[model samples]
Target: MKQLTLAGAIAAVCGTTFSSTAVLAQPSAQAADQSEIMELIVTGSRSPERLDEVTASVTVVDAEALQQDLQLTAELQNILSFRVPGLAPTTNSTSNFGQTLRGRTTLVMIDGVPQSTPLRNGALDVRTIDPAALQRVEVVKGATSIYGNGAAGGIINYITRQAGEDAFNVSLTQQVGMNAEETDDTASFRSSATIDGTVERFSYVFNATVDDNGVQRDAEGDIIGQALYGLSGVRTQSLFAKLGYQIDDDKSLSFTANYYDAEQVDRLIDVTSSINDGTKTYAVKPAPGQTFPGEPQGVDGNSNFVLQYRDAQLLSNTSLTVDAYTQEIENVFFYSTTFADPAAGFSGGNSVIVSEKEGLRLNLESVFDLSGVEATFIYGADVLNDVTSQPLADVRSWVPEMDMSNEALYLQSKFVIDDWVLKAGVRDESVDIDVPDYTTLRMCGANNVCRGGNPVEGGKLSYSDTTYNAGVRYNFSTAFSPFVSYSQGFDVSDLGLLLRAASVPDLDQVQTEASVIDHYELGVAGRYRALNYEFAIYESESELGTATVENPPGSGLYVPVRAPQEIEGWELALGLTVNESLELGTTYTYVEGQDPDTGAYIDARKIAPPKFTAWADYTVGNGLSASLQWMKVMNRNRFAPVDPVTGRYTGAEAPVEGYDVFNLSALYSRDNWRVSLGFENLFNEAYFPARAQAFTYAGYNTMGLGRTVKAGLTVEF
Candidate 1:
């Protein structure tokens, strides 16, 4: 009989198994020591466990990997696209539209504090925190309810840096880069500093970062005007601080605060130059008095505060953890004239959506020796209140304020016997949303005819569901491990959007039902000599999957389509260590989804074509290391035809042509000084991303960035 080893499973989950030499390259001594012990604590696991002991498909990117060559970009979407196999490609904008994981929206968090506004997704959650402020990123694939609502796809948790045992430590980093082809106005600069130390029973870590981005240009030296209004030529600043106090050896308390701000500062207006030859181009014009020059977009401001307490030994073999957090987020979208109603005492400007959340979470875990089997039981409860609203600059309410409250309770048990591991969990969730009576905003049609302002009565909606999951893994030997799992997840629809556009007389009449998703997976992980590999096949089904559809063609009026959907996919990763100085790795991902009713692709733009990524790293001694990486995407012709004029897919489908790119990076470090250089799009390929081509209707058809070079240096004391 062949069984899987914990090591093999961890290798599979990470996509690239790190060799001993690679692990030794970690920056932190504590992390290196933990790697030696093979004890890795993961988010969503409720407790610390060995890598092999984890049953779910989880990917952990440590600080070293996060700073790797191909992942040096400031955009989180770009980094994740190249690293995570199941995630969609980057939209090249601040907004992560259609950037789903496993074809569903993922819940994003920072140190257990939610960043996503599920009540009304602003698509800006992924960019809330600067990558430099993170020590590690954990991604758990597949639908799971362990962390509560909005995890229909999976969860992404960003763990912040912690203070070391040293009395005082300070680090500083600076970088400057420019476009290789057009360097005139395409220069960018970034600076970051960190101070951390441990004194007596108190430990503290503080970090600050500032980034000034220049105009984005393509291979042809043309400015990429299709990007989000506030993405290019923008300034971003982030501040983070964490303080912890050790109360004896069994108890600890921590406080964390983070603030982020991003705004565009360029004074260029977008003027449509041409829309032909399967692409569009925009010229720059001087626009005064405009908030964002080209567009009336505003800044993005996000703030978070958290307090946590943990008791490792409240009782013998028992532990408890509690967390309280509050977050405020405001995201502004590009200006739109569609809602301009001068007759209604309102002139359309940029619209902004605000979301505020306050929550408390509690978890308790206990280990019990039951007969001959060792079991670990975990339970937790969560209470959260979210308030969200969308309003125009003219003080007109586009979407009225909505208050939502959620309560959840979950219980999980894990048992280990010999070479077998069994796990089961269940969660009960309750949700309530309140909407006040209001009149719809007056809107003008394309023909200059205005109609709207319909009175809608206030209503309240409540819903509840119970989800369950089970998994079993057998480690038949040190060479291989195989596992099977079934899990369920649920998400309440975007209530704020639903209520603001509600036409029904009563809330009960409207479909306020939550969508339930079920996931099934079979996976195998194995190690042979210096080679490690993992493969998984999975299927997800949702009876009431949500899809966006254009109700009136060319009118831009869209509505949600509730239909049955099924998605199936497979993932494979391989890693080989040729020697202590050289290593190679590769990953392949394939996913597809279909609507059960019409048998057509559901949200074609959301589907990522088959992708393959390969990388090689080598150390040349003298504290120097270099790496090369390549990524290729296969052509996806599985979509309906597009309308010539509107550029909208007739059946919610559009082709995504494929492209490949190469990258190179080198690093040199000695003593307290480090230097690094990275080259992106090494081949200077002139191509467009799938989203850019598929969304030509919005005049967003633009080419991707060309070859670029970046260099940075870091100093520590």
Candidate 2:
């Protein structure tokens, strides 16, 4: 079965590349000579405006662009890999992980709401929403306006689809493909419709959609290892709705809602599972494991689960324009592992984990005109709540526990002066955390070895601080502008405190605290004639954070510790219109980070290597087009064995080599019908990530997937 899947994937990739090569040979003069108009809707702002007039950096990914790229192998983290400079996916050893922006301090938002949770985990899954349901994606690369807390790096806003200004319409799309590996197959189906009209004093528009997606695989017909979840075959289902009305000639009201549900079943891997009894070994199905508070034997866990999220927005403009929404998340995770001896200790129970989160946000903005100057003022407040619980006699023990609530209020203003734009904003944020005096679990003792501790007397720890930012932009011409900005970000450190308690002498001083980050940047952006470009240099410093080791220490259970770091990087992007039918674009990034005092390079497992990416596309008459893209990542130095006596990653590995990949894509479109084909990793370059120690006990590193291909079609009316 796996072999058949692998064969299909290989055939798909080769078929698409060969089938489209000839169609790409011709260029249409008419197609190359046309000019594009500027009518983009501004995001990260309380008002609407053209893209060029906006004061912040923005990257817009249109729907057509998403549909044309058939390979779709890359997730959100991978899309940003080559498309944006200075941002890379995280490559840690933990399960279900994601990348960060600008070393640290970036935020993820779904239609303006925070997607990251303080208690549940880190950020939300980047792949939760399908591009099929998106009108566009707007990325604001810096810390600016504060809606919710936790956005220290930057912000990513995914704008959902809405009803266009037209009569009733409907659209449908389907995609399927395979890779060079065996048993790998993927498929997806999506449909959407909208209706708009006016009756009497009211004009309304309504839109809705349904989406389902498949999965991808490796060359050997086995599921490839994802940095987040091991193995593969995860599916998702989503439904969306939006409504709008005209209140008056110059005023309007709009509402949007989205309900998303996704899940994945348990997938067994050959390498991670082991069946051994000291002198004897066997290959067999192992029992699932669970996490109990106090138990040493048995296996108990579940792999089936689902996540549901909903968001709603209401807006109006007159005296004050307000936007509000609420979100909730609930999930269950089950599993266990054998830590010490595999023979006598072969039986360890599984853990049942449950998490819940909810958040609310409200914002109001007003615009005023004074003489010849224009000023926009914005203010808002947000509240966040998180709860966690687990029940068991062993690893799945629950005594019913929860975290405290967090609240913040912020205000910002932007002033336009002749050819210069100035802006500043500040937020007052506070956190309240609750905990017991001591855990009932036995302490490791004076020997420095410990298990769970006594339950602590329940109490609340709260603190508040002010974070602000100031920026200025000078317009050199109607198409060019240079800007400089400095921003301060602050986030509560309860997670940091939890990790620090593992090694600290006193856990009381380890109460919830705050960490601050200072970011500085200078850049220029503009469009001249047929060329658009942006260049930026940035540096960010953090006061308190930590480099945690997820695995257990040899004898003593040493958790993570707090440390300071300084990160700096530069980003460059260029887009050129080579006539009307041809376009050329490229993005490049360079980064360096380290401890300020020691000057030691940061660990490799945390950051992406320096990389460069470029792409070119040519269009022929009718509906045929072709494109080629190149991506390369530099070799990275990582942690390896320093000495046989001490088991530690003190120095660097022998420099794991990097790789260069090439991809080709072609498309055909006519009126309301379109078809796309794509070939990825055409040359089948071989490479390896630094190292990961998640499912397995060894510090094993996995190889990247090789060649792959995909094809799809869409019809709209």
Candidate 3:
């Protein structure tokens, strides 16, 4: 029952994000009247419910906090990195390669529409939408069956911004940034426009953001590489629009669309360096006769559309909601020698993943009595179609096209008896996938050893499961509530990882079976006057799970391996509001996972190291406010630093050295104008992030970004 509202999830909660305290710390009368900001839960039950009553762990980053986040960085990965606990840090590139939620893939969504392509898992879902277009973000913790497939960890939903009560409103923002380590050719720019209005029964909101980035450098003033997991010289643009129509007091309809694109423009080649040599890779301009190869690496495009209709009084006390959605996305990866075949006519190769999804959801909620105890029942049916594939651009097929159809029906019951609240839900899901006969592209590692490119007979695959969830909460007093929960999640877990590396003669011989995760959680929440707190512990396990492993050791050919795995973690959050305009908060998080059969701790690629985060914000009534945030990742020594035989730093076995970072932001607003200034990586700490150290790859050991500054101005009319 850690159903703390985004505004109340405070810093004191370990999994609570920084924005938890920010919403309540706003310069508003909310500090005096706590009830004014009581947020309604949406993603928790797939319906609007009271935050304090939801029987699950959820985190929300409200609008005010999202605004504060934008002032600091434009990257969505960076926004979620320090804000959400349990989630791994950003790779600081176009890819979310190592970021995970509780050591598993989290289904990223926009308005209940899935964005993750688990079939191929390009790890680009995190950046599909811009914060400027969203009103808030909701995170549901632990395994879940709410939104079927790829939710082994949980879900992150980005709620679109809304039209305010104002009859008409418009806001424009422009900002520029540069690396503090060195400024030459390092200036970045961003601009956004938002318009919203309400007219009688109609309301609409539109937002657009354009971002142009420049060369990025580490604390040592070396240009960050562009070969892999690099962010330098990229351009990103986001467009979002939402229109709502109220047919009557009891019925409404809405349509939403969002499109995002990012691509590398600047020409910079990576100067590969070895982890064994204790050297960092850096980017450099090409020489006079040198030229780039392959296609520019980044997101080619991502588009999403959703249409929703609701009736508050469809029949008697029953309510109904229907949703329709469509999505398409393509993620392009960097050119690498990992897919090269020296004996063939290939030098090096790059690949891209294309996914298209269409789905429909129908839900109904009814109120009734269950044996004299007040109860509510929610029932829903979902149908989805997804087609995904991965292929080397203009070359050959890697992962053949997989057409999938999914159908699910679920029912949830909630009972309220005096001071006790109990809830349970069950979902029956069926999935069918068809793959055509194809040949796995031949690939060569750095050692010039060839593998794959064999013809595999394809056929139809079917999966079905019944997932269940139950939880109970006891509200003893206004200050304390504790809850226990159990849930299950089903996922196919990167099917393409298996298909592309297929040495099997046929699809039947492959381990294409789905994975089911069992999740358990116990948590408590308390609020005392101006202070709020939350604490939770969780465990997730699977009989057949998947993880990225460097096959054959030191081959640089990473593959997903199926194994029995278990993950456990705990979190705590605390927030204190001093008077009406000052707030202080902090959180601590720890997570770990292992293979039950081998009894060995998982690699850092999946599990995040322990973390500590703190923040302080103050509002000066005179149109000025400032906030400072800090984070520290603890040392992760799960594996040895070097290989026993080669004396080389083993991939994914390199020891991870921890580091700390700080950020500062200040904003001033008067009349119709607002100005903001922010600093990232305050004090310019020169260090490698957890993933960079643990990855132990030639070009992936890049350093974290150096100190950076951003200044922006906004005008309203």
Best by lDDT: 3
Q: For candidate 2, lDDT tens digit of each residue in 442-468?
A: 333333444554344546666677887
In model 3, the Cα lDDT at residue 77 comes to: 82
**Model 3, 514: alpha-carbon shift in Å?**
1.4
Q: In angstroms, how far off is 357's CA in candidate 3?
A: 0.4
**Candidate order by lDDT, highest to lowest?**
3, 1, 2
lDDT by residue (tens digit), candidate 1, 16-37: 2111101111111222222233
Comparing 2 with 3 on lDDT, the higher-scoring candidate is 3
Off by over 4 Å in 1: 1-37, 69-71, 226-230, 271-277, 281-299, 345-347, 554-556, 642-652
User: lDDT for every model?
Assistant: 0.73, 0.51, 0.81
TM-score for each of the candidates: 0.92, 0.78, 0.93
lDDT of 3 at 714: 97
Candidate that beats the other on TM-score, 2 or 3, i.e. the better one:
3
- Kindly indicate the candidate among 1 and 2 with the higher TM-score: 1
